[model samples]
Target: MLSEFKAFVMRGNVLDLAIAVIIGGAFATITKSLTDDVIMPVVGWLFGGFDFSSYFIRLGPIPESYAGSPTNYAALKEAGVPLFGYGEFITVTINFLILAFIIFLLVRYANKAMARFEKDEAPAADPADVVLLREIRDELKAQRGGQ
Candidate 1:
């Protein structure tokens, strides 16, 4: 059982999966930062400085002791107000779309590269037995010609 487990762990597919998971984690971090720091700002600017991150609708009354501004979604929520945070959802959806598109492009390019690598591969070396057989056949042909 242990040997079987070892064999499974040593498989090329298993190693490939492990590597892919590690790379995916790093990629997700990079995409998150790109969305939050770079893309979101540009999107906001394009929308005439309207911050989508703060867009929300109050579904419940604000608490009487709430000192924060009513328009502040975070503050209203912190004050125990039931709100529908649609702006944050939109931003998150945009981030997901960007990440998915990037991953798609990466996969497409990777497949192309793999295809190119396969096409450029050198032919396999002849087996020792085949080489010996060919040599013997050539020697027999040469002896027959000499006769």
Candidate 2:
């Protein structure tokens, strides 16, 4: 059973999948940073400088001990305030779209590259023994036909 498990884990596909998962996680972090730190801020600036992440509707009253800014979504959420965090959702959605598009492009290019490799490969030449055998067979056929 242990050997079987090891074999399964050691498969080419399994190793490839593991590597893809690791790369995908790192890529997701990059995409998140791009969305949160770059794109969102630019979009906010374009839309009159209102931060999208802070655009949440408060669903419940703030806690008495909550000393943070009332309009702060992260602080309010951390303090157990109920919120309809649509801005955060929008940011996450955008992040997902960006990640998905990047992965799609990678897969598309990878497929194209693979296709090119496959198409460019010529068929293997016949072995020396096979070529000799074919020549002998052709000679035999010629002799028989002549006879």
Candidate 3:
């Protein structure tokens, strides 16, 4: 059983999956930074400086005014407020779309690259000598009434 587990872990598919997961984590961080730090700021600037993260609807027993800005969703939740956090959702959805598209592009390029590598790596055709030998043998057999 241990050997089987080791074999499974060492299989190409498993190794590929592990690498993909690590790469995906890193890609997620990059996309998150792109969205949060770069894209969102541009979006906000275009919309007259509207910060989406701060856009939420309060629903529970909380004052209309909070003394300090909440740093994160947990802080707002801790404030005993039922909230409609649409802005965060929108941001997350945008991030997901961007990540998915980027992955798609990567996969597409990888497939194309793999195809090109396969074409390059394909075994060359049999030598002309081998081909001529086979043809001569066939002709001799035909002449000998071997049909």
Candidate 4:
């Protein structure tokens, strides 16, 4: 049973998947930073300093004990207030679009590079027997033409 388990863990697909998971986690962080630090600021500035992350509607009244700002989504949520956070949703949507586009570009570039690399490699030659047979057949045809 231990050997079976070891075999399962050592499989090529399993190792590939493990590496993919690690890389994907790292990629997620990069995309998150790109969305939060770079893209969001520019988008917000373009839309007259609109910040979608801050947009939310409190569905319930805030508790008297709650000291956080009423308009703050994170604070309201932490205070146990029910809220509709549409602005935050929009921000996430934009982030997803950006991440998807970046992945698409990477995949496109990789495919083009692979195609060019494949084109540069010469094709394999026919087997020796096949080549000899073809030569003999061509010679027979030539003899027939001369006859």
- Listed in order, each prediction's TM-score against the native is 0.70, 0.83, 0.80, 0.80
Error of 2 at 20 (Å): 1.3
By summed lDDT, the worst window of 10 consecutive residues in model 4 runs over 91-100
Best by TM-score: 2
- Give the alpha-carbon lDDT of every model: 0.90, 0.93, 0.87, 0.90
TM-score (C-alpha) between model 2 and the true structure:
0.83
Which pairs in model 1 have colliding backbones? none
lDDT of 1 by residue, 4-56 (tens): 99999999999999999999889888988998899889988998887887999
Task: Give the per-residue Cα lDDT of candidate 2 at 6.
Answer: 100
- Could you tell me how far off, in angstroms, the CA of residue 79 lies in candidate 3 after the best superposition? 2.7
With candidate 1 superimposed using the best TM-score fit, by how many Å does residue 41's alpha carbon deviate from the native?
A: 1.2
Better of 1 and 2 by TM-score: 2
Give candidate 4 misplaced runs (Cα > 4 Å): 124-147
Q: What would you estimate as the lDDT of candidate 2?
A: 0.93
**Residue 90's lDDT in candidate 2:** 89
Q: Model 3 off-target regions past 4 Å?
A: 63-66, 69-75, 123-133, 145-147
Predicted model with the maximum lDDT: 2
